[model samples]
Target: MIIEGNDPTVEPSFTLSNRLARQLWNWVWLFLFRPSPRPMHAWRAFLLRAFGASVGTDVHVYPAVRIWAPWHLEIGNNVGIADGVTLYNMNRLRIGDYAVISQGAHLCGGSHDYNAANFQLIAEPITVENHAWICAEAFISHGVTLPAGAVVAARSVVNKTLQASWTVYAGVPARPIGKRTQHEH
Candidate 1:
């Protein structure tokens, strides 16, 4: 039953991902996503595995990784998440295949509930389209899309819509810096 405007777009969540409601950040990750500090590569996979992240093979996660909630994230194949990166995925945060998150990049999807009397809590889904590159210290605010093959320059603060496919965006709020060509290699 496919309706046009009334069609369904999302699924219902019935339970929280974590049952214990406790954090053994090091005690758990150390046993699973263990980092040798020497090999570097081994530690990368180990850390991801520890968080129950569905990480693809050969995906490199730096030691400085900061994941708010690993269960809410989905990273695709051949991904490279650099140092000083934050995956503040309070809800669903999807990173597509072969995406590069440069150092100091922030993937923040969590926020406070600004409506209720208490302004208790809020968080939204942030989908990073496939092949996007977020440069150093870039801040992607909640629910912003970085389209496929989009390149965000250093220190860009993206709080709005970002178009896909071979676009170069750079600014305080991140705008189209230049038009890229298919053969601009």
Candidate 2:
């Protein structure tokens, strides 16, 4: 069997200026924001907004939530991101109104292109629509969109877009398991 070799000459995915800004912001996020107490949601939101995130009112972002690039993040009103949730948004990541991302859940927006010899970095946007709920420890892959009122069960891995609203999805690759009835909030 022949083995593939990685190319050394591929260009970097981000510009030098962008890298510098990101590194600086990352340092700020680590020491200043990450260690803040749980009730300091407004402080965290302030920091994220300072770094270019379009955050809406009443957004609850726990201290342990890690955002790769705040400049690419857009959070809508009343969204709840629990502790240890990772928003790995190399590209744009939009969380709509009333969306809930549970503890330890990961919304990953970046991946490497396996077809490329150098394993070139590829990024896509992830959109969690209004009223969607991503359960604890769920993994949402790059480019996946969770529709309005969609529910991802605990520890589920979602790779594709869940188009139907008010549905519950679970398991590896996340298939729809049941319908969620609409309720008064």
Question: TM-score for every candidate vs. truth?
Answer: 0.78, 0.92
Please give the TM-score that candidate 2 achieves against the real structure.
0.92
lDDT of 1 by residue, 1-185 (tens): 11122212253221233433215554554544444453486566655556666777667777667776666778887788887898887678888887889999998886655554544445778988777889999999888888888888999899876975779899898989886554321
Report every candidate's CA lDDT.
Answer: 0.72, 0.90
| Model 1 alpha-carbon miss at residue 45, Å | 2.3
> Candidate 1 at 171: error in angstroms?
1.4
Taking all chains together, the TM-score of candidate 1 against the true structure is 0.78
Error of 2 at 18 (Å): 1.8
Which runs of model 1 end up more than 4 angstroms from their true locations? 1-22, 29-35, 181-185
Clash number for candidate 2: 0
Error of 1 at 113 (Å): 2.9
Per-residue lDDT over 9-110 for candidate 2, one digit per residue giving the tens place of the 0 to 100 score = 655567777788889888998898989988999999999999999999999999889998899999999999999999999889999999999999999998
Best-performing candidate as measured by TM-score = 2
lDDT at position 142, candidate 1: 85
